[model samples]
Target: DNYNAINVDRTEQIPMDYTGVMGVPITFLHKYNPRQFEIVDGLNRYTVLDVAGLNDNAVKNHLHMTEIGGKSTYFRVLIKNRKVKK
Candidate 1:
């Protein structure tokens, strides 16, 4: 998931079919439900990424640091759905 596209403000729009790791805006925590989702450390940190099994190349391609107009962007919280609706 692209951090630029998904955020807490647009949580309702998130796709339900996706089951892989996703990076979302930190604001998502405000509406977070522990029974439905699991928070994982973002790929921004080396140790966390390593523990999560995300390689450097994967991080570079998907979760690399982002900048808009020369300004760094806010952090994204990595998450995955723990229980999906059938």
Candidate 2:
């Protein structure tokens, strides 16, 4: 459960068994607002494992939002174990 050594900024973000992702969103603040899941964030409202299965396409530079105090605020986060420069 302690993924802090990795990309902890990815709220509610758990690891998965896949070929790994190439890129992920870049959020502003390191903190997030879980209360504003729907309006604030554009995420699938499901676990990381759930979304990747639905859309296999590249989602680089995408926009996401999370809610707080009944308000939806846009935020972007990092996707770990990504493609490193060769």
Candidate 3:
């Protein structure tokens, strides 16, 4: 589910059956697929979107948002690097 577009040109042909989200970079890892996924890590600072289902074709990066919060600041890479707490 790695996106070559992350480094390569976003206009190049991508393989189907591949699945990964910019916001939810990892999804449906096993037989325990949940109907809904929340931002348990990075909530609203910056993430592309929520990936619910995997039946769709290869999804290109999209600007998606969610309404849930309370996720820890440690989830933030920069915050974790700075050792900040909330």
**Most accurate candidate by lDDT:** 1
**In model 3, which regions exceed 4 Å deviation?**
1-8, 22-45, 48-86
- Tell me how far candidate 2 lies from the true structure as C-alpha RMSD in angstroms: 13.5
Model 3 Cα lDDT, one tens digit per residue, 1-86 = 22111111121222222233222222222311233222223223333232323213223433122212422221110001121122
lDDT of each prediction vs. the true structure? Answer: 0.57, 0.31, 0.24
Q: Model 1: per-residue lDDT, tens digit, 1-86?
A: 32332333257755566777666667788988988888866534332545445456545764444333444456666678887655
Clash pairs of candidate 3? 23-48
lDDT of 2 by residue, 27-64 (tens): 43343334422112223322244343422332332322
After aligning candidate 1 to the native by TM-score, how far in Å is the CA of 57 from where it should be?
7.9
Estimated TM-score per prediction? 0.56, 0.20, 0.16
Q: Residue 35: error of model 2 in Å? A: 29
Off by over 4 Å in 2: 1-65, 78-86
Worst 10 residues of 1 by lDDT: 1-10
Winner by TM-score between candidate 3 and candidate 1? 1
Top-down lDDT ranking? 1, 2, 3
After TM-score superposition, the amount by which residue 68's alpha carbon in candidate 3 deviates from its true location, in angstroms, is 27
Clashes per candidate (backbone, < 3 Å): 0, 14, 1
